[model samples]
Target: MVSDTEILAFFRGELSRQVNRKLQTVPLELETLLQDYAPADELPYVISDYSNKYGVDVSALDMRNYFPWENLPLTTRLFKGRNFRASVIANRKPLTVKMFAESARAGRWLYD
Candidate 1:
């Protein structure tokens, strides 16, 4: 499986020709070898903010039953998988797991 960085670099390379004519754009470099990783679907649970905040101890989520917050405990439903839709996460607002957990606990931001 290709690493996310590799995918990003490929995308940049694909766009280089359509970008500014004079400006040179070197693609970002990735040092880690992705061969060790398994296929996306076959991979382990994805320990994203959702997992960290709720203390859900799973790695590499299954894309099939990929309902992020669907079956969580009622009290946690509001917060489970909440991080994915946060403006901070969606808009790339520089949030950490701890901060995200705090925000979720506060029930301040929610997406419809």
Candidate 2:
């Protein structure tokens, strides 16, 4: 893996050039808080976790940063040179009172 300073500098330079903004990169600390909808330690790692810590101009939507390099397809097509996979990374909206109420209002659409 590349050094943190290199990553910081790259972000700094790119942001400065591309968006006319300065990039702020900070070291991750233990005091950082996580939302109930978010999971920590999940791999394919992530870049968004940094914005909350660094206050950088970039957010999770920046594909240059959040691109899931480790999530590449593990399987290839037969007799072809292609590899792909569909993965969904979403905020876990585990049933809360508000959501449960909305679902009840909508009625559970069960086929049976």
Q: Pick the candidate with the highest TM-score.
A: 2
lDDT of 2 by residue, 32-112 (tens): 221222233331133333333343333223231223322335443323243322232232222212321222233431111
Task: Write candidate 1's Cα lDDT for 9-103 as tens digits.
Answer: 43233322222357664332333211112223322232343444445333332322333333346766555455643432333222122332333
Error of 2 at 64 (Å): 7.2
Query: With candidate 1 superimposed using the best TM-score fit, by how many Å does residue 112's alpha carbon deviate from the native?
Result: 13
Query: What C-alpha lDDT values do all the predictions have?
Result: 0.34, 0.29
Q: Which stretches of candidate 2 lie over 4 Å from their true place?
A: 1-45, 64-112
Q: Model 1, 11: alpha-carbon shift in Å? A: 28
lDDT computed for candidate 1:
0.34
Per-candidate RMSD vs. true structure? 15.2, 16.7
